[model samples]
Target: MLYIFDLGNVIVDIDFNRVLGAWSDLSRVPLASLKQSFTMGEAFCQHERGELTDEAFAEALCQQMALPLSYEQFSHGWQAIFVGLRPEVIAIMHRLREQGHRVVVLSNTNRLHTTFWPEEYPEIRGAADKIYLSQDLGMRKPEARIYQHVLQAEGFSPDETRFFDDNADNIAGAERLGIPGILVKDKTTVPDYFAKRLC
Candidate 1:
């Protein structure tokens, strides 16, 4: 069987609070308000799927907050906060690769966020036989079409592949396509979950 994993908040740690802090100074809006915007609109999704360029998205956010910072500064600070990997998760990925199952990554992430991933995490880099970034694909998860894209590109029948992701909605999307998924938890527990029959 093959294993497919989602990147953000699954293989990597995402602290939106840091992002909020960086943009707050430029937006002149309270971090809380910015978070509300994130929750209430398509700002984040649009940015992730590459519908909005970084400059445009940052400007829109600045306009929403009525802040004084330049889009470049806001975007730079927003991108700089993430650091390191969950070592245990990395180890699990390596273990899976050693077992000879094909491993792949499908993430709904923009170019800015992905620019450093290949360098920051080389082991996971080696683990994946193929990497599909949403910005590059022009598709995002929790959406059926993106999942179908991976299925088609990788040539894996849904039944032969298992997906691991942190979001329930994305997991459900995989389920809808007849590709089973496991909601990621502590890395230590994932192997037991996988051993029980994946897809």
Candidate 2:
């Protein structure tokens, strides 16, 4: 089986509240106001799709939040979204690779978040045979074309691949292309999934 894993909330734990808190501290914006105003809108989508530059996205996001923050401050708070690494899934992916399955990552993320984590969590860089990011691909999750692009680029058969993501929409997107997707709910989801089936 060829396994395609998602980065956020699956291999790495993330919390948007961290961003709000960090920004609140930096910009003197109330947590409630930040939470209420922050949006995953077109700017965010464009960032993930690699259509918008990091500075542009950050500026747009700041505008949306009505935040007064310098680039350094915004970046600091933006990066705070990452909580920690989840290597439990990585270990399983390595084991699966040993058994002749291909492992790769397909994440809808941008350079803002991507630049920070890989250095901190080396395993994240090595967990998969290939890591596909939307920022580079100009394609994000829940898009049929992105899935098609990865499968075609990797030369993997859709029927033979399994996609694991925390988002149901992304899973559904993969499913539409005949790829069986697993909805990863928590830390144990992937480990538990292969626990009995790892023969």
Best candidate per TM-score, number?
A: 2
Q: So what's the TM-score on candidate 2?
A: 0.97
Candidate 1 lDDT, 1-199, residue by residue in tens: 6789887767777777887787776556787887775552587788888988888877776676666787677866677657567666666667777887778888988876766677777776876778888888787988999999888887889999989998889999999999999887655446567555333
Per-residue lDDT of model 2, residues 85-109, tens digit only: 8877888888888999889999999
Top candidate (lDDT): 2
Stretches of candidate 1 above 4 Å error? 25-28, 185-199
Residue-level error in angstroms, candidate 2, position 199? 3.4
Give lDDT per model, in order.
Answer: 0.77, 0.91
lDDT of 2: 0.91
Alpha-carbon RMSD to native, per candidate: 2.9, 0.9
Task: Give stretches of model 2 more than 4 Å off.
Answer: none
Model 1 lowest lDDT segment of ten: 190-199
For candidate 1, list the clashing residue pairs, or say none. 27-67
